[model samples]
Target: EPEVTQTPSHQVTQMGQEVILRCVPISNHLYFYWYRQILGQKVEFLVSFYNNEISEKSEIFDDQFSVERPDGSNFTLKIRSTKLEDSAMYFCASSRTGNSGNTIYFGEGSWLTVV
Candidate 1:
């Protein structure tokens, strides 16, 4: 079966530099989302996108963050400026639709480590 794939399973970055996490969501899905787990915190939704533009974004998705589908299969999240608090496991998920019954598939996660 096809699955979501994330790159650089772990990353070490400076506190003020930029970072881009990459993901390839499952094909045939229309809705894509980015979520982050800050060490012991709950998974926080950052943004949801479909049909090219953002459909919904949480307060966590501030001016420093952006996302794009660079190609048919690649979706990337860019953090303009990183912080120590930005270290977390970034997960990429995709669902065929927005319905509750649709189970979203998540990557193993890209672990971001900032210092």
Candidate 2:
């Protein structure tokens, strides 16, 4: 089965540096999403995209964050300025259904560490 894959399995950034996490979603999937789990917290949705535009986004996806599908299979999430609080395990997910309404599969996660 095809699965989502993330690059730079781990990342360490300075408090205000920019960071971009990359993912290759399933080939046939139509919806893509970003979610974060802050250490012991529950997984939280960040944003969802489809058809080249954002379909849904959470409050956590503020001015500092953006997402793009620059290629057929590649999806990326960029944080313009990282904060210490931004340290979390960022998971990229995809599904055949639309945003916020599908049982998406997640990557192992890209761990972001900011200090």
Candidate 3:
């Protein structure tokens, strides 16, 4: 079965730099999401995209964060002016639908470290 795949499995950046994490979600899925887990924290939802626009977003998805489906297949998460607290394992996920009964598939995650 197809699964979400992320690029640059690990990344380290300066405190004020920008970071872009790339992902290719399962091809047939319609709803895409971005979630993150700080080293010792729970997985937190950041944003969800559908129909090429943000469908929902959590407070953690502040102005510094952005998501884009630049191509028909690739999904991306960008963190601007990164901070130490922004370091985490960012997961790319997708599901056929947004309904509760749908199964959400997640990528292994792209680890980000900000100095």
The alpha-carbon RMSD values of the candidates against the true structure, listed in the order shown, are 0.8, 1.4, 0.6
Model 1: residue 72 alpha-carbon error in angstroms: 0.5
Looking at model 1, the pairs that clash are: none
- Pairs with backbone N, CA or C atoms under 3 Å apart (clashes), candidate 3: none
- List the candidates ranked by lDDT, beginning with the highest: 3, 2, 1
lDDT values for all models: 0.94, 0.94, 0.97
Q: Which stretches of candidate 3 lie above 4 Å from their native place?
A: none
Which candidate comes out best when scored by TM-score?
A: 3
Sort all candidates by TM-score, best to worst: 3, 1, 2
Best by lDDT: 3
Which of the two candidates, 2 or 3, achieves a greater TM-score against the reference?
Answer: 3
What's model 2's lDDT at 8? 82
Worst-scoring 10-residue span by lDDT in model 2: 95-104
